[model samples]
Target: MLFVTHVVPVNEPGQPRLDREAVWEGLVMKANNALPFVPAMSECEVVERHGDSSFDRAIRIQGDPYRERITLEAPHRVVFTRLSGPILGTIANEIEGDGDDMQLRFSFALVIAGTPGNSQGEEDYAKNMTGMYIAALEGTLDAMRRIAVDNAA
Candidate 1:
């Protein structure tokens, strides 16, 4: 899998704080719909909320259902596993710790199989994919942080 994680540190040292669950609640459950950080190309809905904050939703990007019933977990760390085509497996989004600050991260892990008939260097593919995924993820988290900061006051 082409595993990649992007982290964006929240600026405030220790302001109004929320637990990991609350953070998950806002970022996953509500932020994608009600909150401003939501991308115009997509929409998100939660079908479940458990101890670890697992939820099911169909991501409609550009009015097309690209993903259905995507399962994202918040156990120990936020992990989103996409169950769809072209994507073998991924831990889409997460938030890690930095004392009082939160480091938002996401991944683009791809499952590739080596073909006997035709061969392609997996390392080169992995490197290209990693760069693209990390850039996009970092931009996403930066946008989210801006939105959160704008509303925090």
Candidate 2:
């Protein structure tokens, strides 16, 4: 098992304001057709709901479905998931951020289970996951933020 968490604030502050709906629009609706820095999941689509936001779509990555429940507000939050498939389960993303200052923070976790016939030390298993899944996720978030900042500007 490997656990990695990061908090990166947008360098600028007091972004003035952009409602959650607007930010969600940029992320799901507008971002769908746009190139995403997170390559693990692909082809995001958003249904414009006038009220609380939610959506489901196919993630080309590993051929899974990522359903999301959004708390659309200042720091729009999304609890994205992919259930079923060889991956078993994944927290596609649980993210929140302000459209102003282009600020955002993403937290994620990845666990690789040992096979029935395999025996690996806890430290060793964690190390392997950190090298692969954790590293990939970190890189993806970094790229996503950079692109969001550039685009927001």
Candidate 3:
């Protein structure tokens, strides 16, 4: 299994300031339809809605299909659990801090279907995954900033 966690400041100097509400909205948007935020995801559709707090979505990443159950914890966190995919585990995006010091934390614990745990291949894969996820986090924040600016206009 590969486990990794990364945290990044939400507010960058000179960028459009995003409040908790805006950030929460962006998270929900990404959960529902990731095509705009996740460059690797070519397609996404809501498969089922488990009420206001949870839902299931089908997404295609790099031409492979997968399903994820997404649970939203209001204005704080969004957790994505892989239900059917090459990799199985949970990935969480959490909002931390208050006011101007807000941060976004991304963490995941995943394993390739047939790969042995703690192997060199797994370690290399984990490193690549970490960099991809960090880029995704930055992209998410950039999308949020754009949304904030558009909303404020």
Winning candidate number (lDDT): 3
For model 1, where is the 10-residue window of minimal lDDT? 30-39
What local distance difference test score does each model get? 0.52, 0.43, 0.91
* Models ranked on TM-score: 3, 1, 2
In terms of TM-score, the best-performing candidate is 3
In candidate 1, residue 77 scores what lDDT? 48
**Which residue pairs of candidate 3 clash?**
none
Q: What is the lDDT of residue 20 in candidate 2?
A: 43
1 versus 2: better lDDT goes to: 1
Candidate 3 lowest-lDDT run of ten: 34-43
Deviating ranges (above 4 Å) for candidate 1: 6-8, 12-26, 29-69, 72-76, 113-121
lDDT (10s digit) by residue, model 1, range 72-92: 454334455555534456555
**Residue-by-residue lDDT tens digits, candidate 3, 30-88:** 99998878877898999999989999999987788899999999989999999998988
Cα-lDDT of candidate 3 = 0.91
* Clash number by candidate, in order: 1, 0, 0
Q: Write the per-residue lDDT of candidate 2 for residues 21-88, one digit (tens) a residue.
A: 44444445423332254445555555443354444443444354544333333235554443433333
Query: What lDDT does candidate 1 reach at residue 137?
Result: 54
Over 4 Å off in model 3, which ranges?
none
The lDDT ranking, best first, is 3, 1, 2
